[model samples]
Target: MPLAVVDAQTLVDSVALGAVYALMAVGIGLVFGVLRLVNFAYGQLVMAGAYTLAFTSHFHPAVSIAACFAVVIALSTAIDLAVFRPLRGQSPAVMLVTTFALAFLLQAVARIVDVRDGTIGEPVRVVGRLNRAVDVAGVNVRQVTILAIVLGVVMLGLLALLLGRTTIGLHMRAAAADFRTARLLGVRSDRVIGFAVFLSAVLAALVAVVLTVRRPLVTPAYGLQETIVVLVGVVVGGLDRLWTATLGGFAIGFATGLINGVLPTDKTIFLPTAVFTLVILVLLLRPGGLFAPRGAATVERV
Candidate 1:
């Protein structure tokens, strides 16, 4: 294929990647809003969902996707019950380190399960049709790419409604603003955090399904790199507000796609270096966040 053709494909791919990363940013930021914890293990939830999809590939696609959601939500709940709940009042550093430990531990567990079949990875063919491309404006665009963009818009829109129009959303916003004050005013912290975890897990499972279509092989380390990049975006966009964090995620993912497409194929190894350099520049210019308000306070707000 011509390099120009590849670059064009990369352009579309970048948009899809940005949409997916924005979803991830919402997942991560939701937890951060309530718990003030980064939850580095967030990627593990996606990995678990991917593994579920892989293991159940023989089932109908709908069933496999449902199972993925079930497994991820269950794991997320378990983590909240065993880890977050117990470590609730701990310092941010302690909670952060615990999430790191949880991430590695989940990865190790995944590796053990993954190798049981004498292979290091599993293929999820349930949604393989998404890998096929369609002609769009004289260009071949993957179905998954279109699906991702549509899904991103729909999910984000629904989320906006949920947060802005629902009672639980109001409570969550209140809790995010000031947990102590919200609690004093009768907001249930545990309920808010649990709901946040549930929503985050749902997004992770959806991401797993989309990702497995992009890369069907499910490995223990699946979603790890994406999580790291999205985290950078969360910080870049401003951790103080959910919308800004999400925008940051999309921006980084979009930039990454462009950079990768522009670089010589063999020199793609420097993609991270280029991406982080951009991040450094952005941070130096606006340490508060690219999308944050001009005089946004340091306090957290969803």
Candidate 2:
């Protein structure tokens, strides 16, 4: 690649990568806020959404895309009701194991399906009047990555509004604070959980589309990468805070991309590995997160 080309690539990669990270992080963060347990199976939702697109693109691209997301939400909600909700009365440790088990189940199912029907790999591309370029410190940058940044901001802003302003949002916040208290106040805990599950499902859809637009073709094992990145983001951003996670996701993406652009190509893998190690170390030092100010807080019931 030309020198000029490399610069644009860095910017493009940063933004595109960041969007995917944010998508995974946000959903994980929200789910954690509600249940206070990590959904180890969360990656399956993304894989499900992407697979839907792969299967449906030829039959009906638009409809299939919608179906892809719908399926994720539906499947996750099923798990929540059938698996998580009933087990909620149990200890969080048990729920953690349950989610991990669910995750493995999803992975096994995906493998079976993949073996039964080989994927028709396809790249998703959105064509329109392209801005194509803008000078940045004497280098031209592509427009698509900037668009990714914009989309991430818009989506996150909308999510913040929904959680901050909506009635269900209030209930979630209250429940997160104190599940018992919220139930006592007539806030149906199930409904709140359902809503959390619903949003997580939707996140699956949104992430699939955004990711496909950036890099077409989905693979069966894709969810594992997403799960890892989101897990790191949540730890780095501070598990209790949404915005912090968002910021951490983007920051990690940018750092990784920039390093990839600048470092020796052979050694580039170290960027992600190092970033992940740093995130883990930071968490060990500050268990709540880099952004969270206080000690591990047990949110009081309302």
Candidate 3:
């Protein structure tokens, strides 16, 4: 391919990748903003959604997608009620460890279920047709790429309105700003947290849909690596604010795509090393946050 062509394709792929990462970042950041807890089990939530899609792949695409969403949201809500709710008011460290435990537990359960039929990694082909590329202005773009970009923008806009206009959104914002004060002011913690989890789950399912189009196999740790990267992106962007966190996620993902594009195909194994090296450098330079304004006091507010 010509250098120009390669650059164009890289830009397109970067945008798509960044959009997906931003979605996941927002999901993680939302919960952290409101509850001050980083839910490490979030990848498992996406993993569960991927498996759900795999199991329901024989059905119509719409039906399978709907089932995926249902399973993820239900599982998210259950986790909150059964695990997180009881641990409420606990130290942030305790909650973080609990989430790690929950993540491992879910992954183990997935492995058991997957190996039950003597198959380790079952591939799900839900909406496989979307993987086909269509030419746009002489450039080939996968359908799912377009879908991801559109979905990310639409979801971000809707969420902005929800947080800006709705009563529930106001409560969530208040809770994020200060959980203790919000609770004292009659903002029901349960309802706010539950809604945040629900929204996160919805975003997770959407991510699964987009991801499975690119990677069809539904493995137990399917979403694990991506989650780890996005979490780092969240931190790099500033965990205290949602928009900055989203930007951070997108920035990291875009950089990854660009790096992958430029690297020799046979030596692509260095991608993670390169990415994290940049991350470390960024952190050293801006411990507060890369996207955060210079000299601005850091405040932990959503």
Candidate 4:
């Protein structure tokens, strides 16, 4: 590839990657902001959605996508009702550990079900056509890249409207600000939490769809790395605020892409090391958050 072409492609890929990370960050930030608990199982939810898409790959794309959404949302709601709900009001440490166990449990189940006869990954090609690239301003952009960008913008806008204009959104915001006070003031805890999880699952399914397009081989551990990276980005952006977390996710992803673009292909192995070294540096300099205003009170809120 020409240097210019490579740079353009890198920019497109970075934007798409950042958008997906932002979506995941939004999901994680929402739950954390409300419950003050980081659900480590959130990645497993994405894994489940990927598997759903793999299983339904033989069906019509629309049907398969719908099934993916249904499965993820239902599973998310079920987890809340069965696990998190019962443990509500427990110590944050206990809840966090429960999520860790839940993550392992779900991953193990997926391994058992999908890793048959030593085969571990299933190809999901329902949106395979999206892998093709098209020329845009002399740069080649994958169709799915455009789709990812569009989805990210639309989802973010809708979420903003939901939080700004709707009653449920108001309740969610209130709960994030102060759950106990919100509950005491008539914000239904169950409703708020359920909605947060539901929305989180929806975002996860979307992530799975985009990820499956980029990497069609769905495995039990799919989404785990991305989730971990996004979680780090969320913390780097400032866990106390939602928009900052989203920006943090985007920032890290963009940095990753930029690094990948500049490094020789043979030297790509250093990508993770470079990324994390930068992360450590950022943390050392601004333990609170990279984007957070200096001296800002680190109030925990959604």
The Cα error of candidate 1 at residue 192, in Å, is 0.8
Query: Whose TM-score is higher: candidate 2's or candidate 3's?
Result: 3
Taken over the whole model, the C-alpha lDDT of each candidate is 0.91, 0.73, 0.89, 0.88
By lDDT, the best candidate is 1
User: Can you list the residue pairs that collide in candidate 2?
Assistant: none
Residue 110 C-alpha lDDT in model 4? 96
Expressed as tens digits, the lDDT of each residue in 101-135 for candidate 1 is 99999999999999998989999898999989999
Off by over 4 Å in 2: 1-9, 117-147, 271-273, 294-302
Q: In candidate 3, what are the lDDT values of residues 202-259, reduced to their tens digit?
A: 9999999999988999999999999998988988888778888899888878877776
User: Per-residue alpha-carbon lDDT of model 2 for 189-287, expressed as tens digits?
Assistant: 778988988887887777776665555666666677768767777778777777776777666666667767776788665667787788868756776
Which of the two, 1 or 3, has more lDDT? Answer: 1
User: Residue 153: error of model 4 in Å?
Assistant: 0.7
Ten residues in sequence with the least summed lDDT for candidate 4? 1-10
lDDT of 4 by residue, 1-302 (tens): 34534477888899999999999999999998788888889999899999999999999999999999999999999998999888888887899899989998999999999977579899998999999999999998999999999999999999999999999999999999888899999999988998999999999999999999999998888888888889888878887778988999888777667767776777778767766776677667766678888987554334
